[model samples]
Target: MRLIFTLLLATSLSVTGNARIFYLAPGGSDNNAGTIASPWYSLNRAWSVVSAGDTIYLRGGTYAYTQQTFGYMVGKNGTSANRITIKNYPGETPVLSKGTGYTNNNEHWRGGCYLDGDYITIKGLHFAGYTQADNFVWSGLFINSSNNVIVELCQFYNNGGGLILEGASTNNLFLNCDAYNNRDPNTGYGNADGISMKFISAGSTNTVRGCRAWENSDDGFDFFDNNGYVLVENCWAWRNGFIPYTTSQGGNGEGFKLGSTNSFPSTVLRKLTNCIAFKNRQSGIHQQESQCLTQLYNNTVWDNGWDGVNFHYLNLPHTFINNLSFDNDIAQVQVSGNSTNTTNSAGTGTNDGGWTVNVTAADFITLDTTGISGARGADGSLPVINFLRLASGSDLVDAGTNVGIGFNGTAPDKGAFEAGGAAPPPANQPPVANAGTDRTITLPTNTVTLNGSGSD
Candidate 1:
């Protein structure tokens, strides 16, 4: 009987030991047990007690901070099977704000949340009012050295910058997020971006999907000095590089700044697909000295202050397919790279090697810029709009080569959206393995790197 009791107890403990739910409220106390009714006060308290499979639900309210460096820091690790989740309570909103009096030294930076945890998920939180007038800048959510972290449905506004992932962060996903109105007065509205993924380690991959960035001081999305593969899909950026409601010039207002460094030797391939960038001060998509391979597919850019698509670099290898660029201040596509171009629509490009069709206002249902920055759907998807979708019988339909991504008609459509069909499933194929090339190792060498890019 004693053995039977021990066995049953062990089974029960094994089933329930790993997972626990903690609650955080703006008015709660840390001395409580973190229950739903008696919740903890701060994210710091939750971070101190959470383990793998543990969840911290933040109740609705303002969580203000005055710290010079980090308002709240998370340095925990969860497993692959069980992730640590810090999310808003269902049907409620949690806002994280920095104190108005927050000021640090001229050399120091500040962040509302510093997340360095692995395998964590943060969802449905709003980070706002994180501005500082000091010489340094601030980030709403700063993620560093973290792997497999997921940040979804978050909004960042009125801050120095938005979400920034850097320094060896790998495989992190930012989904259904919005970053706008982020300006840095210290640099004359420079050095602030909606999403900045910089200095990531090589051989790692990060994804940003279904996000929006607008009216930020700097670029909408800046991938500066990253050596990893970044996949950006279904995102939008507009009206950056200018102060809101004013003509004051902001920072370098490129919509998507795809990397800047030419020093890294890794095969860093950045891919952007199904994205829209418009009305920026600079080029919509600028490949700023990223000598690595970049793949741009099914993107749309219009009404930019400079070239719509700028890819002038040192004859770097790039791939542009089914892209549409029109109505910019300067040329449509500025290409100096040795890129594979196919079935694109551009006006006045320096290299018109791949120009196929001419896209005009007649090709779209509505050129009116209305409701582009409206509210998102309940499921946090992008706002459905007819701003740039291809009209019926437009030449852009079925005018693209198959690039492995799914298409609707006999071939893929030219721009970001297919003209007349539901979205298709991903390409179905057999599993193929690629172990890179054969390498000859010296006697003293202990290891060698293998290539997996050929694998699908």
Candidate 2:
């Protein structure tokens, strides 16, 4: 009995200790040595060898290619816990690309890490572009699968495209990523969107948090032909252009652009919170021909070339809450065409001749005493507005409706940030370490292990 029990326990331990690690160097080997000293030469080689629960570490160094065309076509799939992770080794950014001197006009030569598998985690790498014109053809990371994937703390610059999450990718997240400086030679336009969710059929919930999109030739974040729930919170976009325009279409260049062509069970529940948009040539947030419940709260829209918020063909049941607008050339909120009554509250508009509170139907605007003072109604009660901006020394200093959403335990100041109280500092920055020299593509004799020991 003792001998049999010992053998069974050993077998269980073997199964539990099956975590493997692969390393990728600037110039390395793909042999199954499983040592940082002996690493894989290419990303595809690592992908081929890693199992469902394996992690491939890319060591610090610019893994540049002499050839103009170098791309990684992934072939492996992973589960939720055993998902394959391609992350920085420990100390530096793993630069992944073909070569530097290549011109952008090579249409056939496409490159960048292409992902088709599910449950993948890519972190802490810099994806650089080949040529200015090539920015339209290549992408930093292309994701097609779904379920518990994370793309965090990556830098994508001058690429043909940023991150593309398509093909029913649900429960995926893009956190703390940056995309800028992508240019296209064909249209004299660039494809430098921070993130784009296109052609999604299923109802996926994708959240973009603490990301920055700037100076992209197109809109900062574009949701094209998608029918999914998207939440963009605490992100920044500046100096981008929309379609049909060239130079910095300005004013954060249409912070959020939504268009649903087919309208079959149209995209629903788009929310923007705690964001700031300023100094773009166009409106801060623009929606066109989409019947979705859009909500904008605790955001600051200022100094845009046009209106602060512009909408056309936007259906009813939209909520604009607690936003501050100032110094825009047009109205704070501009709505034309036939549309249902959207709620507006707790917003302050100033410095423009346009109405501080402008609406197609005046009866729909309601100011609530729960927020700071602004527009008064004939009944001597405050109309309930969607967004409320607190004036200096105003009673709204601590007066706000506790909606119990997105509150960070501060006193719930009247506006986005905790007034008089410090705004909660941005989330802790990701650990700074080199990502290039960390991953070595080597097959391990031992199986990969999955653990849930860390703090949740």
Candidate 3:
């Protein structure tokens, strides 16, 4: 009977073709057919029929994971040509929430969607409002052993962890995602961060591009015991450790905690380029105990409670080029060892200026967020705001030297925002009909989900 059923399934697929899309809706029933008019209520029901080269479309509505269990697609593998995609339906936002009583005791239960599949893509969905279950570090999206995965344009709000990439997950890309207000009361063992990639071996290479992480309880971006190469670029981390929404306190609240809770080499070789770390409670851009080829280029650290750029006890030939800092506690840029650095200036020369001409916040147009931190440009890059722009007559306008990256006037602008660089062209949008690398499905497999939006 099982063989007959398998043959029937293959024959049905042959009649349709390869590839499909499944739809889910809040008002739908689990027994309903996974179709547009008759959508499946549970992601598990959609998973029962979905295969490689499939898309899962979740319609616009609130999915209460507590009332109805959270959705997850795990332990499935998709071939390169037929990657599984789970995303928001076109032109609508699918909100996933875990209200109170997800657990009676208030322990973290790894809420939201847990993904353990490889060659998958998750995009354009939002997760929020889950009570910690068993205090076991939960996340809106958890990816474990998932290689070649792409998670972009999703969001996390008020969850324990926004995104957790863990356990031998390799060659994944997370782009254009935002996280805020995620916290766990676990105190010293803080279980909250905008994003975390932990316990990953060197073989796991990941990249986060054009993302924003703020107001998280713990660090904005954290890597705990990741001996891997994770490149983070054009990202923002700010206003952490203090809840701007409420008068509550936050966790460590560092902007980018490159490596923590272990030795240095594990965190070395990770590259942070063209990133911004500001207004965090701790050091803006910090790394400790490293002796390897760690790279920091074209980054901006400002208004952090501690050192704007802190590289401590490192005997490595690290590179810091064209980075700027100001308004830090001890000093602007604090490094324990001499590094191969240049064009890095900070407050009191203890910053990136490194005994050169020291500049203050007076060099900027406005030290406040008058125009910056608004909407991004068409290309999804940082918006062109004068909030931190160098004045025409300011010394920082062209003080930076060429380091083989794009610049406006003479050199790169001193900080994350370039002085007058044009916004990059808009990237490819999703719900593609047909093309190479574009997601598509036939009439028989019309159920579909949105794919990720690409960023740099």
Best by TM-score: 1
Better of 1 and 3 by lDDT: 1
Task: Estimate the lDDT of model 2.
Answer: 0.59
**Which candidate's lDDT is highest?**
1
Model 1 lDDT per residue over 138-247, tens place = 78888888999999999999988989998888889999999999999887888889998998777789999999999998889999888788999999999888874466
Candidate 3 lDDT tens digits, 137-182: 6678777877999987888887777888888888999888888888
- Give candidate 1's error at residue 235 in angstroms: 0.7
After aligning candidate 2 to the native by TM-score, how far in Å is the CA of 14 from where it should be? 13
TM-score, cand. 2 vs. native: 0.72
- After superposition, the stretches of candidate 1 with alpha carbons farther than 4 Å from their true spots are 1-17, 68-70, 100-108, 263-268, 348-353, 422-456
Task: Compose the digit string of candidate 2's lDDT tens values, residues 54-147.
Answer: 7888888887754432345455778865777889997677888756564333423344566767778888888876433432456666677566
Residue-level error in angstroms, candidate 1, position 432:
40
For each candidate, what is the lDDT? 0.82, 0.59, 0.72
Ranking by TM-score: 1, 3, 2
